[model samples]
Target chain A: MIDYRGLQALAMVIEHGGFERAARHLFITQSAVSQRVKHLEALIGQPVLMRTTPPKATAMGQRLHSHWQQVRLLEAGLGIASTPNQLTVRLTVNADSLATWLPEALVLPDHPNVSFDLLVEDQAVGLRRMRQGEVMACLCASAEPVNGGRVAFLGYLRYRAVASPEFIANYGLKDLSRLPDAPCLVFNRDDPLQHEFLATVVGGTPQRIHYCPSSEGFVEATRVGLGYGMIPELQFRDLLASGELVDVVPGYALSTPLYWHYWQTESDVMLNLRTQVIKIAKQRLLAEA
Target chain B: MIDYRGLQALAMVIEHGGFERAARHLFITQSAVSQRVKHLEALIGQPVLMRTTPPKATAMGQRLHSHWQQVRLLEAGLGIASTPNQLTVRLTVNADSLATWLPEALVLPDHPNVSFDLLVEDQAVGLRRMRQGEVMACLCASAEPVNGGRVAFLGYLRYRAVASPEFIANYGLKDLSRLPDAPCLVFNRDDPLQHEFLATVVGGTPQRIHYCPSSEGFVEATRVGLGYGMIPELQFRDLLASGELVDVVPGYALSTPLYWHYWQTESDVMLNLRTQVIKIAKQRLLAEA
Candidate 1:
């Protein structure tokens, strides 16, 4: 069996790009770094580093390092010595969602016993991590439920084709076809949801777009007439109500289904969470679904 | 604001039974239950119960009950005394991911000040709660990237269309299109990713699907020839390698893009998680744009 400490030392070496630097980072001797890497390679029966000017982690090293990191996080959560009923609940979520509804869900005072650990990520990655056991729950796009879990369909979150009136006045998008060529604001290149919707309408990905990675920035960009992008219905609703945002596509918007999925494994805490979420979805989101 | 005691009383009533039963559950008189309910109703500006036979909760009462449940779960995590580090992290994640990758990200021994509380849930719902601030992080769907944070585009998770040899021989799905309407094992009705992929290839959604809500059951079902479903590449790779399973769609499996998102707010803990996740993603996941 490989010693975890040896593997950890080697990882630090690779991260620092050299044994000498790694020694400084870990407050150990440079020779120790070299020794650990050598020991790890001997145990794995594979070379874990390249003996180059700036040392690089071999494929084996990278894989092991990745695995080691996961072990570390798990240990941290478990390390919390429980005092009586002090159980920690770790959650993964997206930032915008954190800013919006999570606060509403965690109305304290009533829940005196529970404390939280928040892991924020985008919807896509959050699900992947959740599946990996990095987090306990997530709000994700795949309406398809997870196995060993109950599916609480939170319904589709609508996206309005929004733009500031000033922008609309400048570039009158008379039809959906014109959107591809228009200067559009996008969350990022990876955000193909808007493109997917546009493809459904225009038959292909849009050619003209600018990347705004910030959620607030994306909305603000649209408001300032950077271009028309699909803004979440909830955020745009008030803006639309205030006449700040005009729907480029009136009476039509793209919506992606959202689902709340959780493990079916019976834990009083987890069971309660699932039930509460389902109830809330039934009240707030099921109608939309 | 409403008194938490009233909510607690309502919870007891709901959990126990009618006012009389609730009184027994709380070890209080029936009249107290009646009074507490009335007080709660007045506080929320809505009636919570019928006050009649069997005493059903009203619509607003249901909402309150759900809220109370979330509080209970959060309270469970917190225990009694409030900790100085109340910026708790809560997560809902799948077990496989937790088993394989998540722990490595959260528990780096070096980061001592940072702590986590974990809740395991299905990937989909984790995101929903994250959006609601019920959790700070989640593993979810949607590669489009969220704002107020950076998106670390972790590579796509590939799922192979595998089946046990027995299943392939019995169903003869060499050409997936030729297979008769065999019951395709699925996590739940909401899980349409695989179905959507099939729809794209088969030209429509299949009419017959066997739902397996348990992850283990889903995997076992596919292995035992109950049906074929797309299984995660990591878990099923060995099965395919050993020739225990056959790939229905060789070289045609689906790969879902994953991303890591978190608050850009100057939070040491969130930043640590974000950095760790990105590093791991680059190494383990298919690191692409």
Candidate 2:
């Protein structure tokens, strides 16, 4: 059996990103922390931590982290109250959901003892993080599950093409010919949504664009007349209802289908989170078309 | 002499992430787009794009993009009415500044023709993006100039350790003994400020942490009792003043010194931006000690 002491030392080292800091956390000497990890490596005949500036976990080290995380989850499931409600659920979620309805799921009492380690990533990028063995669950665009993980269709996170009233007036965006000259907003360089949406409706991309990486800031930028792009349903629903946001295409909305990918475990925390997130997603997002 | 058509085709393909979409924007066939990029590669004796699934710019491609961007900026600076007031200024900024005083810079009338391409990255990583030939000016923490790029001190972006009322009450965080049990919040995996701040103030990291990457969402998560985190001055100043956020460590604030690194150019647009941003930074951020 793997030593819990060494596993913990490895966990602290990787999580905190160094041995000295991990030593402080584990209430052990820096050399002791190193020795514990080294001993584990000797036993396994594989290096766990790479000796980078801030030491990084190797693939073996990542698996070890994943294993330790699962052990913690199982401990929580079995009511092993050694630490009295101190279990961090590491989850990676897309920014849009966090800005919208995921907060409801977080506050729900199903996992009262559990806190969270919410890593906000874009959907296209989040799956690799899961594969890296860092997170317990990922709210991702990928329908395929991670190594032995399970995936459930949450629903299509509906987005509508929107711009502020001033933006529309400034560019005369009602005319498709003028659309090429108008400043557009995209989340980042990787976001194909704006260009793809434009390609479908207007036959091209905007000649000029502003890439605002923040979800809330995207809305604020749009409101203040920086540019226009796809805004999520709940985020724009109130704005569109109050006429704060005008439709770019007038009748077009895009729905990005999402999936909840989680570890295939009977651990109560994982199961509870899986159920709660799916339930909230169903309520918040549009039904899959 | 290099061809503008081929350069534009390369830019469109990289920006939009595909050849087909790029062709749609350029009003050329997909084959024409591919051929233009190929011809440029043949001229340079190096591949511009990696031809990956979503084709990525190689090092040569990125430098070409950078040269193209500087040319665009220079064109605007020269009042060359070639594109009729259309230039996108690509910049990577730390999110806190964006949340606070950077928007003021955006609205200012320094570069009337320039739109923005703002990529939000943490200070630790923004430097690499600037080096990757993605951005012309980078608002970063790096004091070092990038490949003869001009660097100026923009003063310190101050952050204070803060938590909502209920979190302090729940964790009894006033006592340093109870601090380890407190659930803290950090921006993301690469963010060391929270733990580093805690280590200095209380001599250890919090046992648990939540990673909220969004500048706006960080404040919202803290407000909604997700977890306590270090918040920026303009973001948490009102909350702390109103007693909505309580200081985790009273009388202590962490100031992160920031620098603006811009492309070395005599272009009026570049010069104007440097002046405006520096002026705004001095007004908004804390003076370096």
Candidate 3:
């Protein structure tokens, strides 16, 4: 049988990236931490850590870590005498979602004991974190549920290709074909929304593309006429309404369907967090499937 | 001979993610974009792109795109009658470098035609972008030169494990072993410097860890006593001196050596940019390396 203490020590090492730090986190002596890890490795008959600088978990180690994390969450949900006050809800999310409706969802009642540890990445890649057990939940663009997780439709995040009035005028961009030569803003190389919209109107990449990774920074870059880009309808509503930004192609936009995936747990904290996210998303995002 | 125009068209399709957008970027009709890509594929006797909702580059296509990007940079550097006014310098950098000395390097004299497209990632992973031709230059932890790029030693970024005065007093964390129960802050999962230091002092990870991804946010969280964290010497010098924060293990710290890697090019812009970076890094960062 696996010793729970040894398992916990191993998980902490992977999470903290060093045995010494893991010992500090476990409130134990360095030798104790080392012995626990050695015991676990001896039990398994193989090495768990790479033992490189800032150690990495082997595949077996990753699986073990994932298992321990899930078990901990399950125990915490059952109120099984764990450190309840120190429960952390680790999750991955996209920047746009965090900027728009996520803050409201985070403040929802009934999750007083849960603190957040958010990992922000592009929605396209966010699910990988959940799959790898790096996060317990994820807000992603994928509609497919994780192996044992429940997926909920969270509506579409509408994006309009927009630019400042001065940018359009300065570049004389009357149609989409001119976009290739004009300065354009992109979230990152992985972000495909701008290209998806451009596919409908023109059909190519912009020669002069400005990459602004921050959600607010992207809007600011667009506002300052640094480049034209696809801006979220919810976040850029004020700027669009006040004539600070203009749609490059009127009535044309891309609507990315988003989904929330969470582990199927009996925990009230998980349920409450999921419900709050759905509620906020429905209220703020486009209702289209 | 390979058709340069068709290659350009194919590269745009990969960048923009579809033929329609590629056409728009190329200032051509959708049919023309389709024809160009088809012609290239027919000549190569294989499909280059996976025609999905958001098109993706095939292995062959990725190679072609990388080659095209490099060629474009070389052409631009030679001042070979391209869009001279729209020169964009793409690079990847670590957050601490971005927070500390990078901004000053960006404003160096004699580089008026250049604009920036910066990708913020961990220094350990930043070099991969340069290797993949995703960026022309990178600030990375690796001292080895990329295939044809020059590597310059940029000195060490020293970090001290620090916390707010109240937190140290409240937790009575005289040594590292007590860190497990106390709150601790991490930059992210990939950041192992804190754990590395802890391994020397305690030998385990903290159980109650908070991840703050932003450079400023991490410092703010540490200052507010949400948790203790490893902070860069250059960034937290003022706070350390002001008594708002205290070193958890005084006189003990980690110094990570950094390096700048860039494509070996005779292009005046590339040369000027490299020189300016080295100059600024030497001035602000530790000069020992």
Candidate 4:
């Protein structure tokens, strides 16, 4: 097996570019980086770094780096004390979720030992990071168990079809079947919620669909009469209350189930965070419906 | 912006426990851990760790750990290389896909810089992980775009209700409505593909649903006359070809559309992966039939 330190050194070399740069980043001499890389090459029996030009990792080097990340993540998950005073946990999150639930969920406030490096992606991608030992835990939608991890249900995110009152006035939709003729705002072509609803109730497809990629914008488009789209209840509640938005279908709503997935490895901080997230999810989001 | 290193150090401390243990794991001295922790505290103007018997991070420490995770992912997406050579791309995928598409997708002939960590989960919960930045990408069923990313339609995973000739003879499922009354194998309660098919085609529900979580077991259960199930086309292809497993509905198959979601970042590696994935998806998975 290759030494862990060598892998770290090679990783630094690749990241920092060239021996001198890596040496500077590590606060060591350029010769030290050269020696480490040479030693790593001897151990791996392969040239991990291309010594020419900008100094890049060979194909084998990239693979080693990937493995190194896995080792790091595993180490993190094991909760095997690395340093009593290191105060950081990498967090993966979705952007809209960051804007909404995360602020609400992470309300405990102030820690010197812990600092958050938030990576915002879609939920599915985040789960991948969790399993790879990248982030310790994640909020995902998968109910299927991840290897070395436990899965929990976080409850459904209720959504409803809403449009600006102006839209309603112009489109004059009295029944579901007429929705196909009206312009509609969608998150993208893949969003099937609106399509499912239409297929279930209207027996047709929306005639015109506008892709509004942002969550806030998707809702705003509907509010401004661009078209009808399903909006999450949490973000749209006040709008509905204020009558800025009205239900296209008063009694009908879409509820999507959310779940949390985390490494099953015993980590006190992860355990605590998961507990707190679930508690808030149940109290603030799930219970509201 | 806060120095991300501080957060990483803090996360390590929380994971490890005491300064001595953390120092050992980090290959540093106990004094170094104490110094870093102290420095972090001074920077944040808050005490993240409690000096108890074992030492523990405060609630604030926990929050920062989670926050730090997200930032690391964003940095990756931005191609802001960390620890140079070791670039780990994490993702959550389903077992079925792992068995089928994943190995083939990762058929890179020794490019060592890229290491893939596969987190296996069901389609239902994969989305949440994507949101958390745990992974850079995911294959999920949701059409809704995540907060910071775009949703791309990969293709549909088509499944059909199949059973052994003997099983069908025993159950006598001549009509769709008779399905609910007969013994049926299901992936889980969330395995609503069959239910949706029944509701859409027969306007009824299954009577006795047997839960068999494993993909292999689902097929076996149906073949051995345990129950009928909606089996994926890929899994049941050989059986169907051999006339062992017969499709209950020949022309009718249930198709679930899957989408690939990733952070909209300008990383060369991510872009390359996405491009390759799309190419394979088009060739292997049928888009429209």
Off by over 4 Å in 4: A1-289, B9-26, B29-85, B108-111, B122-124
What TM-score would candidate 1 get against the native? 0.37
**Who wins the TM-score comparison?**
2
Question: Model 2 TM-score?
Answer: 0.85
**Stretches of model 3 off by over 4 angstroms after superposition:** A80-85, A107-115, A121-124, A128-134, A202-208, A237-244, B1-71, B81-89, B94-117, B127-135, B139-208, B212-289
> Candidate 3 chain A: worst 10 consecutive residues by lDDT?
A106-115
Measured by lDDT, the strongest candidate is 2
Write model 1 residue lDDT over A41-93, tens digit each, in one string.
Answer: 88888998888866777767767664564454344444345322223345664
Q: Tens digit of lDDT per residue, candidate 4, span A1-289? A: 6777678778767644467766755678888878887888898888998886567778788777656644654455555578332233456654335434544354222222233334555666777777665565666556786788888787777778898887787767875667887766555433667878787778876544554444554555566555788877777788899999999889998777777777666455556667767887786565433
Ranking by TM-score: 2, 3, 4, 1
Compute the interface RMSD for each candidate structure.
Answer: 21.8, 2.2, 5.0, 23.4
Instruction: Report the lDDT tens digits of candidate 1 across residue range B110-162.
Output: 33323244444555566655554444566555554344434556566667677
- Kindly indicate the candidate among 1 and 2 with the higher DockQ: 2
TM-score of 4: 0.43
Error of 3 at B155 (Å): 16
- The lowest-lDDT stretch of 10 consecutive residues in candidate 4 chain A is A107-116
**How would the docking of model 2 be graded?**
acceptable
Docking tier of model 4: it is: incorrect
Give the alpha-carbon lDDT of every model: 0.59, 0.79, 0.76, 0.65
